[model samples]
Target: MRNGLSTFWDGRGFDLLLVGIPLAFLIAISGSALVYNVVMSFQEVGMFTLGSFVRPFAGLKNYAEVLSDPQTWPILGNTAIFVVGSLSGQFIVGFALALFFGLKFPGSTYLRGLFLVSWVMPGLVTGALWSWLLAGDFGVVNFFLRSLGIINENIFWRSDPAFALWSVVIANIWFGTSFNMILLSVGLASIPEDLYEAASLDGANVFQRFFTITLPMMRSTIGALLSLGLIFTLQQFDLFAALTDGGPNNASNVAQYWAWQLSFREYDFARGATVSVMMIIVVIAAALFYVRSTRHEVRG
Candidate 1:
């Protein structure tokens, strides 16, 4: 016991202990939840059966039923749109912001830091703020559009089926842009100053330098950012809950919100678990790409 205590306090045992703690914690928390969720997807779970270790075996019944529902395809499509639209908007706007800051004007660091307001802010708070901004009657958004003659009347951003999902997409872009900008800025800053100077000496214009030097250097960063964005967008539930509630005829419905609605609201545990499992599969794939991107970062 004395020798073991000395070993633990002295050298490799400390390393082992540090590693073991996180591993054990991960297994205890995420591992158990993942396993239980996977198991529930294959069982016919109900209010009464939910308490049991085993229920009626469903096999592929839940999967089949979820896939067959008419709303299923539309919701999936909406999820796809939400992910793509939100990520694209965030990336484009964030990349522009990053490039702007890279120019390093007076107070640029402070200005760039200010844009992280959305990133540090709570999702619910952001959603509520946007809800007011996008409101039909008294919304500042419609008022501005009307003042500019862009729209003749108020646009019910959250309630209109045609605009509901896009409204959420807009808010999501605002919410996520800060993170994208910060990461992209780091990538931009890491490229050697000599490269830009050399390009400038060779008569390369600003656009030429960006395309030939900045972009190629940023490849791994962009890949990692995209993969992270995909996973982050998929897990966006609070924004939908606070803004749309998957309403206006489920027009804004996506998988995460729909999964919650199914399990808790509709008491369809099996289907809920199945939906989450499907999302998990997509996230896992995205995670693999993220790993690959990071690996390439090392190689670069």
Candidate 2:
């Protein structure tokens, strides 16, 4: 009788339909989609229409051509500069703000709210407004500078390749700092007060206590925040698209912008897919490294 009851329950509909089937379906669908895209990247895919297939097996030739292109390396370099510069600035500024707000100050709460307004704004609008301010002639920046006797004429922030990248970097830094600030502030608030008291008892200064105790306690949180920051910054496109449109001879062109240009402007879907795939690989690699490093820290 026990054996019979066990067999009946095992054959019931709940296990197969609710649990097993959906899990299998999800795995199948996600796996198939990933495999299909990876396969499509090997062949030439058109932007407008899928033409008749002549030969689909192109192998690593697409990847090789993409790597061999002169523009690829430069675009990647710009992406690196944008990511690192924006992230570094954002972290430093955010950490400072977090530290400031962690202390009691008049109107500090209101100031923190005001500071987050930039992060709340849409990326396209942020980029467009910054672009206007940094415009060469007739911009408010140039007008104000001339009024202050700083410059006789407008400065071409976009036209000058050297300044254009920095322009976008500044915009991104302004927008991204709030992310780090919020995360770090939460981490700071969560830290136990007893640790600080103990440090004070030991005659530790603010800087020393922060470095020795606060930093160690907040390490995991900071690591997570930084990983998320790197991922978002690496995939940054809307800001770049709206600000410079990868202009001035592609000086500000990043891998994301380059992919969009190829797919839409140049009408080369195959190459665009190649760029996208490479970006995926790079992001995945970076994420793995970050996760591994953080886990090691936790273990040690």
Candidate 3:
């Protein structure tokens, strides 16, 4: 026992032990939940059966039913649109801000810090604020667009099928940009300054240096960022609840929200769990990629 204690203190086993503890805890809590959810997806789960685990087994009927639903495809498509739009906007805008702040002008740090206000704000609060801002009548967005001659009339951003999804997309982008910026900023900081100096000495312009030096160095960080962003975007529910509620004939409904509606609103717990299982399956790939990216990151 004394030798085991000494070995733990002296050997790398201690590091393994530290890692294993949290992993065990995660499997105990999250793992149990996931296993139960999968079981519920296969078995029949309802309000009355919620107290027991010995519910009727339905096999793949729940999965088949969920997949066969007409709303399934459209909601999944909206989810795809939301994920793509939000990530694209957030990363592009965030990368631009990261590059701008990388220049290190006076007060740049303070200014960059201020941008985190968006990150700190609650998602529902952001959604409510955007709901007002994107309102068709008397909205600042419509007024500005009209003033700038960008639009001839007010847009029913939330209610209109054409713009409903995009409204949530826009809000999500603004909500997540700060987080993206912070991660990209750290990635930027980690890059060797000497590489840029050398590139500058070699007559490389700002654009040239960024493409060759900045991007190559940031590949790992970008991978990790995209993976995490995918997970977050898939799990997103609050903003949809606050802003669109999958309105205008399910035009803006996504898998997460739809699953919730089935589970809680419609009391189709088995189908809901099936939808959730699919989401988890989709996200697991991204999570694995993020882990792999971190493992393969270059260290100086």
For all predicted structures, in order, the TM-scores are 0.95, 0.82, 0.94
Candidate numbers sorted by TM-score from highest down? 1, 3, 2
Q: What value does the lDDT take at residue 157 in candidate 1?
A: 98
Under the 3 Å rule for N, CA and C atoms, how many clashes does model 2 have?
0
Alpha carbon lDDT of each predicted model: 0.95, 0.84, 0.93
CA RMSD, predictions in order = 2.1, 4.6, 1.8
lDDT of 2: 0.84
Best by lDDT: 1
lDDT of 1 by residue, 1-300 (tens): 998989898887899999999999999999999999999999999888898886999999999999999999999999999999999999999999999999999999899989999999999999999999999999999999999999998999999999999999999999999999999999999999999999999999999998999999999899999999999999998899988999899999999999999999999999999999999999999999999989966775
Across residues 162-181, which tens digit of lDDT does each residue of candidate 3 receive? 99999999999998999999
For model 3, what is the error of residue 229's alpha carbon versus the real structure, in angstroms, after optimal superposition? 0.6
Q: Judge candidate 1 at residue 224 and give its lDDT.
A: 96
The predicted structure with the larger lDDT, 1 or 3, is 1
Best by TM-score: 1
Location of the lowest summed lDDT over 10 successive residues in candidate 2: 47-56
Candidate 3 matches the true fold with a TM-score of 0.94
